[model samples]
Target: MASSTKPPPVEALKPITSVSASPPRLLPTALSLPPKWLNMYSSFITANQSSVTQIESALRSLTYIIPGRFRDAELASESLHSSIQLLSMYHDTLLTRAISKLPGMPNASLHNRYTKFWIAKSKFYRRIATMLTMIQYTELLWEMMAKRKGERVRWRIIVILELVKAVCRLCLLRITNSRPLVTPALPERETIPEEEAPTEEEEVEMEEEVTPRVKEYKMKRTGLSLPTLPNPSDISSYLLSKVLTADDIKAPNTLLNKVNGSAQLAEILHIIQPVIYAIAMSRSKDKKDWQPWLLGLSIEYAARQLRKDGLRTTALEREQWGKRGWAMGWWAMRGAFYENVTKGFLQSTSERLPSLVSGVLDDYKYLWDEYYFSTSSN
Candidate 1:
């Protein structure tokens, strides 16, 4: 006779709140804040919900914690560090570890759970993207403040900034990059095959190994430049850290084993276009074509993705993005961030930058006009 024994008891998942029992030891200072802000964050942390509700609460609190102009460098830095630490913990526990254990298709209930989990994960990534952008702005603010104050800032700020960069790495690592808005987690090319399908285990394993990492920074230094002539690497590092550090450029692609399609890479270039232009204008005589190469290689990859997924078929994809118009806004935002940063930094660059950037802005507006009208009429 067949056995009637039940399967082993399933273990309960750990609470998301419990995942980060303590703040990071390396944080510049403990995450203390003014009484009011501390109270707000305390309430957010104690809440029992495990979904986007907590995310919303944290966002609201974060807005207040990050001051309008970043005064009280120590306090602001601590608050930002604390807030990101909590957000990162929430990401690791609720989305990365817990939700992934749910069953996939076969069972309707479990399948729905998995689908919802993915949606939640995607939303969380969007939030992280905003926070990531804000962190870059914080770095900018620090530089501006130091310049205005005419004194070197504290070393504590450096500790905090480095930690925040680490946080960027962590956020990128834990999230999915199969689409845009969700930055690509790695920097390698991807290829998908029509035949010899991967097993579920294999797919899971591959996704876990996902990486299209951002490694574009030229130096490790930060804040106002010293009076001494800075090295070339310093300039590259300063430029990259001012806005984005390859987050938008990084994509994890499976089609043809690459993450960036040409448009997607173009999207990255477009975002970094300002930086490339700045670097080029600063060193116009250096004729190396990596920036264009970056765009060209991505173009080739995009073609491969298109040919593999659409070219052989009768149905053409209407999406202009790397995948089904998924990352369109995010890709656009990368360009926007570059524009915003470049425009601001112009005060320190070539005197003509202001006019040049304004012209670029006009061209951007015109280019997007067609996209806007076309999409709206559709």
Candidate 2:
């Protein structure tokens, strides 16, 4: 009996508790992939990469279409103009159609698709540069003819004026539409009303008293966030005015000696205001954020248009100036919104967090150098 009893006390398999084999080690869930369309679009941008060469070709091809070019006589002025008008219309229509069809709040895939479509469309309209050049040229011709009453023909001038208007519209549309959606910000405006009347003694007293109070209030309330979608109509109006009225497009450095004394200030202001608005809108939470990327794009585009003579500064200088303008704009925006731009830049690109603060400061410094030194030197 004693021998038969405790047969090695059979190690009581204590209910095998600790998840027998660690609960079947779960394999990681695969990340959800972007749709196929998006992959295709990204591949397209990579394949048909934009470069200085494409930009140069775009500008040169368009220059060929200019009305008064040295070798443009193969076609009649009317014929060339018609050809340009048709090409412009076609490209404009294509862009408009593509934009209208784009889905809102598109995922990364959709963004890639849109980008690819735009790049491809841009290639198709390598002729646009010519159209814009011609438009600018036509406007100049019309203005010159206006000054020379002896050279003006009423009917022909009417036709040319219409063409100019048409071209200007196209230019405005292209610029405004080409811009990816920007975030919206508050327009500059006066919140307080001025009194219609005040006594001389009271005015002096009010100036001393009310001015400080108002200034303090303004300083306190100076900053604000912007909206996402600005009215495209508003941007169009601003762009149209600049394209038609820029003195460089009308005549050259003659305005350098004029009333304001800044040769391109008006044009700069015109371009800057909308660009600022675009940046604000790009920072908006509701839409796809594009301000930072758009800033980079705008700077690159400006660089493409610039060239150097024997001057110490080159087109790179101009591009650098554009970036400086962007940095200044962001600095102003921080003040305008009553929020810190550095903080905003940090928050915007937070996923790339480690270098965020220093990066913005570096950008600010680089831009300042470009604006104050390079642009002035050029």
Candidate 3:
């Protein structure tokens, strides 16, 4: 006891009550990982990639098939037409098939990109094809017979524009499938009794009020006979008619009489009405929407085709001054649409967005500067 007392006092350990230890830190629970959608995405990319390669090949084949020199002397007219059309059909079928293989909406943004690429690329081909056949290009024009140094027995670049028409309809189809609830049900028609029908005098007077004779072309299709997807002619007459707008439809035809193409106005509706309806349906509940911008692009595409110096436009374009009013209207819509696209593209992070925006503007440059401006008043 004495020895223990004599020993130097070591520092005493803290009492259990005084000693404090921190609680052990917990490592976060391992997060569950999301499923990789690699396989599905791979299929989509592969389909598009293969299609691109095929398009390139088709272009090359056409270059070979179409003689480099516009040899009116050597080539037979019937044979040349046969070759051009046959090759065209082959290429068209391939492209359509390729486009059809594209994966749909699961990764819709990507799907839209490829589909849009096909549309633009198809247009580029049209420009080239048209250039080949125009009067301006001395090299591209071949003789139909000895006397005529005309372009080949051509339907406008029927192949490419047909593809565009397909895409427009496809877009409309998508809009329909979007199933927006905005479309109002058809209002029930109030049928007048036979006794209450308009008098012969009134009917005669009403008929007399009509000034210009309009030949109406009603486009009809059979549902039972409807071909498999990417049908040749969904918007068959898009290139044939002017782009219809919301304002055009809302106003009574009496007011629209000033425009020459009033008879064809329904054609405009047939083409654009479905598109507008689709846009309304496809837009999200959120305030921000791109439907108008999308429509602007459509307006530009349709109107540009109308003005193009190619087969499609060449066939449809007439010298009538009245027909021009619709072109001007399309221009206004295009300007508005371009503004929206410009804004959206500026804000977009996607790599392809800028190019698509610029590509459209670049292709249409001569349109605004040389064509539209020259046409517009000072």
Candidate 4:
């Protein structure tokens, strides 16, 4: 029988009440605030306390609901549902208000007061994706316990179909609502800036004056300064650590296989279209040529695999999820945790950080191993 259950009512969920957009700056010990100002600050907190409580409750509800559908699923398990619930709730209540009302927020900053909350939606999608993975696990367990012939297969197909629909809506909602708004672009190059073009006479004169000797020397020196193509090692461990590692690190081997399957791989690829574009663009001096290659490679890989495996193909079908995985990977490399980027031990926290993180993770691991060995000897 088909699963009659609907996808969770993501849209129907109530929003948290807005909080004060501008929080007061910390008072210096010597500069006592006037009695009236102190009273006003106290009153603001008191008024918003109830609203904060409600947002927390809502997030708690979301976390509770995640595993409730599966009789076997545990509420306290090491899954992303907990992180999503806590983070989203905090974001929806505290961060959202600040972003909407706070003045002097840094522009184009992802972690600035305006941008931090955007991570909430993306994190929500990650949890939802993880929960869908658990659903697959439950189905497999059901199949193993099935005594009647064909019972497992019928139910598995039904559950898989439902999951497909739920995932589609989940992705649509996430992209639409994401903070910093994840926008997808079709494969195309932007037109060159008009000002970059020079007159024919000027171009000819410049070409003649710029001797082959100077050109060769410039090229040689520039090559040394330019960065090399990124290898896997180039990705900092600190960057990787940003990917919210759920308490549930123990994905069943079966789940891992499913994740790596052709269908699943394709799905992830489609969801991460933005990241794919970014990666390809980052690689090239010109954005136009590389983007087409990136898009084409993902599409072709999925299409060919689908054809080879004879997976169902239809007009309504979206490519299976390697796109989302790519996005997740990018986030793992670039996203931050609770640590604010505004302050650091030394240097503006916003500065180029990937290399710094890479060095730290490398040294830390070696140090840890040395400590373990010394302790064991004692």
Supply candidate 3's per-residue lDDT for 246: 42
Each model's TM-score? 0.28, 0.19, 0.19, 0.22
* Candidate No. with top lDDT: 1
lDDT for model 1, please: 0.40
Badly placed stretches (over 4 Å) of model 2 are: 1-78, 102-378
* lDDT tens digits, residue span 1-378, model 2: 456665455456456574366643333322333455555644443333333225434654663434333323423443444445444434433333344455552222222233333334555333444344444434433433343453234224434444443454344335434221111100111112223587799878877774332122223365654434435779877665446333223221121122122323333333344334333433454323445435534543453344222344323224434554464544333222313344466446654656655554444333232121111110
Give one clash count per candidate, in the order shown.
Answer: 23, 11, 1, 18
Q: Tens-digit lDDT track for model 4 on 101-198?
A: 54543332211211232234356544544444444324323332331346444344434434453464346444433211122211111111123489
Give Cα distance to truth, residue 373, candidate 3, Å. 27
Candidate lDDT (C-alpha), each: 0.40, 0.37, 0.36, 0.37
Candidate 3 local lDDT, 36-61, one digit each (tens): 34445444544455454466457545
Report each candidate's C-alpha RMSD, comma-separated, in the order given.
27.9, 28.6, 29.1, 28.3
In candidate 2, position 271 carries an lDDT of 38
Give candidate 1's root-mean-square deviation (CA, Å). Answer: 27.9
